[model samples]
Target: MRAAHIELTPTEDDRRIARYAAAAIALSVVEAAIPMPLPGVKPGLANIITLVVLARYGWRDAVWVSLLRVVAGSLLLGQFLAPGFFLSLAGALASLAALGLAMHLPARWFGPVSQSLVAAFAHIAGQLAVARLWLVPHDGLIAIVPFFALAALLFGLANGLAAAKLLEDAGRTRQ
Candidate 1:
């Protein structure tokens, strides 16, 4: 007879994971409040929380945190189902995938800043693709890629540095 796979229920430690997820979501909301000159652009400070969760809690929990952030952020901003919401959702999902893949890479090969750059680039690319394919459906929008790339690189570096610093501090405390 073949054995079926069984999933185990959460223990006390699992509750901690849930708490981390909640914290990540809350951080995202707070990050949303900080404004930039551009309307749609953001520093993505919340990514620091996501990165911490991914490094500590694992990818599955990180995903839950990210999804909750997107949903809650949209509702809070009163832009649910709007183009901005879709763009944010796409960017978040893309960043999650990039971060997941980066986590599996050898630690020496990629550090926090590099991982953040890759994830940021992926997020921008994903949103642009969505815009071209579904939202705009016109070639004129392609012109914005260079600007977005520049912004993503700058903000991504900042976010990556912040996350790396947080991680370093956390490690120091643990030691």
Candidate 2:
């Protein structure tokens, strides 16, 4: 049987999204290289990109960036379809869901900082749930919550501020 050949071409929008996704993936690889004092306590610098995309583009675009970061990042790290990938995917989906809802809030009251914090907490919750149910399955895992929460709060706020600055710079450059 002759093998059917299928060719797919990327549109301009696809190319744009690919650029953003590549940026996010780069951050992910860099984050993975950094040594962490505590498990799952990295600063999540990649998420700052997500926040910017969400504000400038939309939630759907942000979701694409986040999902691509997880899948492609994991593949680059040679951890595709592994336990870590699953946890990361779960965390990303949770954060995206929170961002989706948070975007509906008033922009004045709920800016990038608020949205970042919300996503960070949601990410931790999702990862913890997966860790408890699938990875460890022990009550002791709950003990890590307070620490993770604190990390999420601090990193989330910092990432939010960074994203805000990036957005501001982009706006200025565009003008």
TM-score of each: 0.84, 0.95
Q: What is the C-alpha lDDT of each candidate?
A: 0.82, 0.92
lDDT by residue for model 1 over 37-113, one digit each (tens)?
A: 76656777777778777887788877877777778777877879999889988998999999989888888877788
- Cα lDDT tens digits, model 2, 1-175, are 9799998998877787788999999998999999988977778889998999999889888998899989999999998999898889889999999999999999877789999999999999999999999999999998989999999999999999999999999999999
Worst 10 residues of 2 by lDDT: 10-19
| Backbone clash total, candidate 1 | 0
Best by TM-score: 2
Model 2 residue 11 CA deviation (Å) reads: 1.5
Query: Which TM-score value belongs to model 1?
Result: 0.84
Deviation in Å, model 1, residue 74 alpha carbon: 1.2
lDDT of 1: 0.82
